[model samples]
Target chain A: MKVGFFVGCNTAFNRPDLEKAVRYVFPALGIELDNLEGQSCCPTWGTMPSIDLVGWCALGARNYAIAEEKGVDMITVCSTCHGSLARTAYRMQTSPEVRNKVNELLKEVGREFRGTARIRHAVRYLYKEVGPDEITKLLKHRLDGLTVAIQPGCLSLWPKEVFIDKEEDTFHPKVLRELCEALGVSAPHYKQLLECCGMGGMRSTDMEKSFRLVERKMTSMKKEINPDLIVTGCSSCLIQFDTSQEFLQKKGRIYFEIPVLHYMQVLAICLGAEPKMVTGLSRTPVDNIIKRILQG
Target chain B: MKIFEDLQTTAEIALVKNNLAEEIKELGADKLLQCNQCAKCAATCPLVLAGFPFFNKRIIQAILIGARETLLNDISIWACQSCNRCTDLCPRNVNPYEVILATRRMAVREYALPALAVEGIRSLYDVGHAVYLSESGNPRRKLGLPEKPPTTLSFSNALREVQAIMRKTVLADLGIIPMEESANF
Candidate 1:
């Protein structure tokens, strides 16, 4: 199957490995991955409710419009962008009043929103389409000694109106964990597997509250079980946990230098991509995770 | 602590929000008509599990009666993790998640607690960026930032620019004011 990749602004700028990992894994699964240019932020300003919602909607609609032009299904790596674009599409199609209003606004800039495309996050597309059995068959690397704590951010679940899927029993689905196991690793169990990374407006607005939230979760992860890495499904959470550890350490919180790998990035390493290519060193805690995955 | 029943006048707050959002009036009043106070939402709420005082049924009742003061002051709304566990588990799709986020947005405006919302909004107003990275006159080289922070636009100035666009958009009729103009008041 041919798919159009909506490389979100964060992934393009900061977490390039998420994009690289996707490129590496899908070809193995017999899927042709394509990237489109001029894709912008879905601009989820509505999360604050104080920002201009129309501006956000217009920006997001522009993205969907670009993807629709390609005449292929669009896939996004960022859950935040996926949720925003999906909600905009739903609102535009379902509410004629809203569609007319948004279309009217877009007319001024010569961009009319036709709302013809469907957007899916990479995680959802991978699991539902690729299947656990296919993922198991493709594993070439064995990750025997390593254990992982699965962390999925809020945008991936909840607010069911946008997600439109039956809530899975495991927030961080066993699919990713099972994929890891197929590649040879032990998955750790944790209670609040579905907790927010405090990176939402909470972290950007209130550092103390945000840090306290992450600190609390990290502390729990350390005290409860010492996993070899903290693998996550969201780019925002990766930044919050990966880059914010220094701030957490200054506040006297324990340092959890635990590697945070995107699920595809982990799979890439198992598929034998280079440490730099698979682990994404610049914005990741890659050393130990790459070592563990490769050594096994 | 006052529990809203003790408030002197809730009518004014209700009128302001209702005048802005008709759906608020419906959600605030009509939606709770079938509510039997089963406590199912409260019991299953992720917030309550996290020790937050969010009682889903109680919030619905409070909104129904136009008791904005009580609902605005409650910590239950912010405490919601937005995990939607309660909404999903609810026998009725009471949708506690939507209710809490709406109420919290209203409360942020009502209480003028933009500062309480996060330092980001304030910084976004003061400087172009989201947070207050440094002081106004601090040497740019010392901080290691790329350059000096952007100029500080007055809160009102920033609000005016955002409001101008919101006024013409579909969002204008949504009843959310976008920003609390006189938060100090």
Candidate 2:
């Protein structure tokens, strides 16, 4: 099967290592990926979406049109991209007036949003297209004896009607957990597993308040799961968890640090991609986890 | 921690600012009045837990009471994660996240937005990515990826396409950022 890889801003810039990981794994698994050249931002919440609903759909439709013209579905590792683009398409399809207005704007560029394309979260895409049992067979390395804290991230499982690949239970999500299980790891439950990572707009606004959320989540993970690492499905949550612990530690907000990686990065290592190409840019030291995983 | 009981009894804060709720509806919160104040959205909102004074439920209450200036002056509205958790749990189908977002639209017109929000918009316009970083090249190179991913960054025509599309949006009319005719992109 084939899909367009929606390389969002954070994955492209802030965490290209994750970008590299996705690039490595998809081809290895024999799923062809189209670049969807000239694809723009999802025009995140703080941008067009905050400006106006029609404007939000217009910009999102621009990106959506790219995949539609390519005649393929899209997938993103960023929850914000999935949420924004999914909701944008949902709006375009639900309202004829909004669809006509967005298409009117798209006419300037000689493109129209036909609403045939869908943006699937990368993890969800894998779970649906390539089931976990097949994934387990493809692993070059296994994560045996490792315990993990799972972060599904908000956009992956919320406002369920808009998403094409939704959780069976929104609040009590289990897809990420089952995906982790395929790697031969134990992903136990934590209270703040589904809480927002204070990434995106919240982090961009009041960082101190944003870190308060990280503090709460890390605190819960420490008390409840106390896993060796944290694995998240969303790139925003990945960035927040991978980058927040240092500032949080210096302030004495927490006494310990847990290494973090996006699920794709770990899977890349399991698929035998080099660690430096996947986890090299990590802020929190993941060398130990790398050594452990690679040893198998 | 006051919890917005009866719209806060502060003498300095005014209520019923006259059709602020109506103005918000025009902006996109068409279901702004459908809310029955069940507070389920607030219970599920991250902003409320983050100690922000104005959040999903409270922002709706503030707007319903026509508290325009008060909502504009507060930065809490900008901090919403837009997770739609509040939107998911609301039984009345109010879509409280849209209310907070509509409040942001009103705030943007009045120039009540935070500096970073403006920066994000400017970046979105200039680079086609809301969170562009010039220094990301070296790190990307180290990872064996190109200095720029095959996004609008690497392709000039792509960047121009994004600029062309953004020009037709309400953002162009609001004049929030300098959408230059000849930007250095």
Candidate 3:
């Protein structure tokens, strides 16, 4: 299957390894990724209510327009982009009134959205096209000696219909568990595994709310389930847990020094992909485990 | 502030009279009517488990009885991580997260909530991405990402899809459809 790639802002920059891993594993599994260099950010998290909603819709619609222009299906690495584009496609495809109104607004700017493409996040792409059983067969090594917790940020789930089947419930989404099994790791049960990182739009202004939310997750991880690393699918969750852990430590509630990583990095490890190639580890504290997996 | 003051009260009807009632009925009040308020939803809520005072049953009961005042005035609604744990576990299917979302939406419509609260909503425009980063430099470069070409979306396709839906749904009368593909397809 030929799948087009929409590299989200975070992956393209801080987490380039994710894109690298995608390139590494996807094609090998018979999934061809066509990169549309013109693809833009999902812009859902950047929006503030004070700004016009019509404009956000236009930006999101513009992304779809680019993919349609390429005459290929859209596959986004970022959960937020997937949600934004999916919501835009659904609204535009299902509600002509909204479509017309939005188009009227876009017309003033010379952008038109005909809704020709379908949007799928990378998780869905892997689950649906690659299949877990197929992915399991590709593992180069086992992820033993690792007690990882699965953190599926809100963007990945909730709009449940748009995603792949979870291996478990929203809190214990089986997607990551299945991914872990294929990679040879033990995914222990953890509370709030699918909770929000609390670093949504509020991270900029309301630092306290963001901290409070992160602290809660960290505290729970310490008291409830202690894992060597916290595995995540969302960049924002990576930011909240990996970056925010420093903040929580200052408050004298340091339960653990867990490193958070994108699940793709784990997949790359199983596929024998290098650690340095995966991005977003500058702040992560679990370098040893990752390096151990890579070296072996 | 005053919004929080009015919301901290116990009287539902009185809170509504204080103009704290949102355009949409908030969650947590209908418990007496249909909800047993047994704490099951809260027990399952990711936010609650994460240590926030976020209770799905409380929010549900508040909204079931038209306690718009309390729902509108409360700040917990804003703290929802949108995990939707309550939506999945709600034996009654009350969808407290949606109620909280609606309440927040109403708050956003009437008064300016926190700027970040609206950032997700505003991100559709100004910056191509949702979380506002510096607009001056290349976004990819600023975030330590590899530089890439800017992207463009097809306006016509989305417009057609929206138009088709408008024709089918009740939204047809509003003429909310875009005027032309170039301007409002």
Candidate 4:
């Protein structure tokens, strides 16, 4: 099985370690990942999509055309990418006029969005395609005695009808939870599990307000489950949760810290990828957790 | 920017009737009339939870009252995470999130966007990604990957394709960012 890798912005620039984790995990499990050669951003919420509908769909269609030529679906660890690309595809597939205008924009670039390829979130892809059973069979390490609070990044699950992979009950998504469980960890519920991580537009606009959201989620995680680690399926969520703690602590808003990792980073460690490459760039330290995962 | 400061009196509401709502609908919130002020969207919106003065319901309220300048002058619209939780939970099928986005489009036309949003658009035009870090080379190389991940950064031609596509969009007329004609795409 092979797929195109659409490495979105935050993953490539803000946290390349997550990129390394994805690179390490996919091939280790016998799924070949194509770079998709010329993929770009999802154009994220703050950019094209917010500016013009055709521009957003045009950029997305260009990326989709690259994957279509390869005759495989595209996948990304970033939920923003999953949301952007999937929503664009849904728009074009449903509206002929939108597709025509987008295709006209793509026509200048010598490409066309045939609406053939779909964008898949890497975690959801693993959950549905690889299955937890096949995943456990390939692991080199396990997370026994570990408890986690899952941040099922808002974009990956919501506006549910537009996405390729969806939670049966979007209000209560379980894909990220079950994926964490496959690693031998106990993933539990948190009250603010579905809240936005204050990334994208919110973070870019007013970080104080952004931190308000993440701090609320963090407080809930610390109080309700008080899990050993925070596992999220979105790259932007990883950046927000992993980096905002120090500021939150400095403000005396929160009294504690919790280590955060994207699910792929944790999977990479379990697959025995070097910790330095897979999880090194985290802001909230993961030293003790890494040590524990390696010892077992 | 207190929202109630822009609250329309009965006479003022008669003078400005549904103008902003029509503009929002044309921008992409085509289902503007469907919203019945259910406030179901407001109940679940992160913007509301984060205490933004104008959230899904309030933003709609602002639009219905033709508070164009009131909506534009404030940064609350920019703070929307676009998580679409409001869209997901809305009983009216209003897709309140699109209304937020449509409001953003209206702001862009009036040059009311935040500097960071402008920076993001500038960055997207230059790098084919909205969030490009010039200092990412060392971290990427330290991880045994290329200096630039295989994106438009690694492929100059792809960057040109992105620029060409950008040129054809509304961005061209807005002139929010510099889109030089360097590529034949």
Candidate 5:
């Protein structure tokens, strides 16, 4: 399966290791990754989406057009890009008036909104295309009984109408859990499993309140599941959980630190990619988890 | 006697209809009127629990009744995380998150947006990415990848196209960024 990999701004800049992990895993599994060259930001929710509908859809269409021109669907590791791009595509597809208006706007820039390409988040791609069974067979090592607390991130499961890959039960999502199970890891349930990681535009709006949300989530995970690791499908959530633990600890709000991993990073490690190349830049140490995965 | 007198005074007041709900609907929140004051959105909202004065539930009611001034003067609308939990769970399919976004768009028109929001918009216009960092290339280089990751940052022509699209929209009218004629295509 060939696809255009939309490495969003955050994944490209903030966490290149996650980009490295994607580069490592997909080719190893026989999926070809194309750099959708000259692509811009997903424009994120805070920018064009907040401005006006046409502007939002126009920007989103430009990104979608890049992949559509290549005759392949686009896939992103960031849930924000998946949500923004997919939501915009939904708006353009469902509302002909919106489609015309956005197309008019796109016409100025020499692009069109054909809605030909599909937008898939990385985890959903692995779940749907790669299939957990195939992923399991491809793994050089299993999780070896590691327990993980999963944060699917909000975009992967919200406004179900727009997303092509909506979970069967959005309120109680199973894709992330099943993906982990396939890797031979235990992803136990927690009350705040579907809660926002308080990242995205929220952290920019109010850091204290944002941190409070993560603190509440971490507190719940520490109490209910107390898993060895926190795994998330979104890059922003990965940063939130990885970096916020330090502030929460310094504030004496939490007593323990649980290592965090993006699903691709974990999959890369399980696929026998070198741990240092894929995960050495993590804020919360993964040395122990690396030892555990390597020993098995 | 005093309570009766206060009630009489309250009844003498006029109810203002500012058409804020209609404005929000026109801005793409068509379900703004479907909300029946159900607080299910509030039950799960992080901002509501975080003590923001207006969240999905209250923001809907405020807009329906044309409480335009109250919304414009408040910071709660800008604080939405855009997680869409409210959108996902609302029984009326009101899409409270869209309402919040429309309210934010309304806020932007009046220059009532938060500073961070302005910065975010500015970054998108200036660098073609909302979260561009100058030092981002150092890390990409360390990862054995190109310093620029095939985005608008690497392709100035794509950035110009993005800028051209933004110029034709409300962004130019909002005056958030200068749209000069000299750069016309």
Candidate 6:
């Protein structure tokens, strides 16, 4: 299967290792990756989407047009990108008025919104296209009984009307859990599993309150599951969990540090990719997790 | 008894029936009035749990009552994570997230937005990406990847198109960023 890899800003800049992991794993799993050159930001929820509907849809159409022109569906590792782009496509396809307005605006940029390409998150792609059974067969190293706390992130399961891969039960999602299990890791249930990571625009708005949300989530995970690592499907959540643990510790709020990894990074490690190349550069130290994966 | 009377008088004075709901509908949240105040949104809302004054349910009620000044004065609207969990769980399909966005749009028009939100918008216009970091290339280079990923950062033509599209929207009218022709990428 071929797909255009929409490496949103965080993965491209903030965490290139996640991008590297995607590059390593998708090809290894027999999915061709196109860079979807000249794509812009998903514009994020706070940027264009907050401004106006037409502006949001127009920007999203421009990104979707890039992959539609390439005749391949777009896939992103970031939930915000997946949410923003997929919602735009949904509006364009479902609302003719929106499509016409967006297309009229796009005429200036010399593009059109055809809604031809499907937008998929990387985990959903792995779950739907590359089944867990196939993923297990491709793994060179199993998780070896590692337990993980899952952060599915809000966008992957929300506003289910727009997305192509809606969780059967969004309130209690199984895709992320099943994906982790496929790699032989135990992703146990936690009360705040579906809570926001307090990332995205909230962190920019009020760091303290945002950190409080993360603190609540991490406290729940520490109290309930106390997993070896925290795994997330979204890049924003990955960054939030990876970076916030240090702040939470320094503030004397939390006593323990839990390692965080994106699903792609874990999949890459399980596929035998170099840890430093795919999972390094995390703010929270991942050395112990790396040692566990390599030796255990 | 006197303090309670004063509070009641203030609430009565604060009530104004403006076209706030109508304005939100124009902004694409046509379901603002459909909210039943069920608090399902508040149940999952981080802003509400974080002790913010106005969250999904309250924001909808405030808008329903045309509490424009009340909303504009409070910074709670800006703190929304836009997680859309409320949107997912809303049984009436009220889409509380869109309601919040509609409120934010009203806030932006009133020039009531926070500086950080303005910065986020500015970053998107200036760099063609909302979260662009100049030093990010160093890490990409270290990862055996191109210094610039194949985005608008690498393609000036695409960035220009993005800028051109922005120029036609209400963004140009908002004048949040300089949308002049010379501001070309």
All DockQ scores: 0.10, 0.72, 0.18, 0.72, 0.65, 0.69
**How much DockQ does model 6 earn?**
0.69
Q: lDDT-based ranking, best first?
A: 2, 4, 6, 5, 3, 1
- Kindly list the per-residue Cα lDDT of model 1 for residues A168-203, writing each as its tens digit: 653445555665566666777776565666665455
In angstroms, give how far residue A166 of model 3 lies from its true place: 6.0
Candidate 3: which stretches are off by over 4 Å?
A13-30, A45-59, A92-96, A103-116, A136-142, A162-172, A201-209, A219-225, B1-22, B25-77, B87-102, B109-111, B117-124, B132-145, B148-185
lDDT of 3 at B124: 23
- lDDT of candidate 3 over A1-296, digit per residue (tens): 78778876665545555667677667767778787654556654333212233444555676676677788788766666766676567657766865787777556545578977778767756876777788877777667777777776676776564343333455446776676666666777766555567765445545676677677677777667777677787766776787877767777767457887777767776777666656434475667877767654
lDDT of 6 by residue, B62-97 (tens): 877788899999988888887888988897788999
What Cα-based lDDT does every candidate model obtain?
A: 0.58, 0.88, 0.58, 0.88, 0.85, 0.87
**Against the hidden true structure, what lDDT does model 3 obtain?**
0.58
Docking class of 2: medium
Runs in model 2 with CA error above 4 Å?
B1-17
Which pairs of residues collide in model 6?
A: none
Q: How does the DockQ of candidate 5 come out? A: 0.65
Q: Tens-digit lDDT track for model 2 on B18-61?
A: 67877888888877766667799989888987888888888887
C-alpha TM-scores of all predictions: 0.70, 0.96, 0.71, 0.95, 0.94, 0.95
Write down the TM-score for model 2: 0.96
Q: Which ranking of candidates, highest DockQ first?
A: 2, 4, 6, 5, 3, 1
Residue by residue across B1-84, what tens digits does model 3's lDDT show? 554344334335444564433344331222222344546668756455445453566765565456666665656666555555
Candidate RMSDs in order: 8.4, 3.6, 7.8, 3.9, 4.4, 4.3
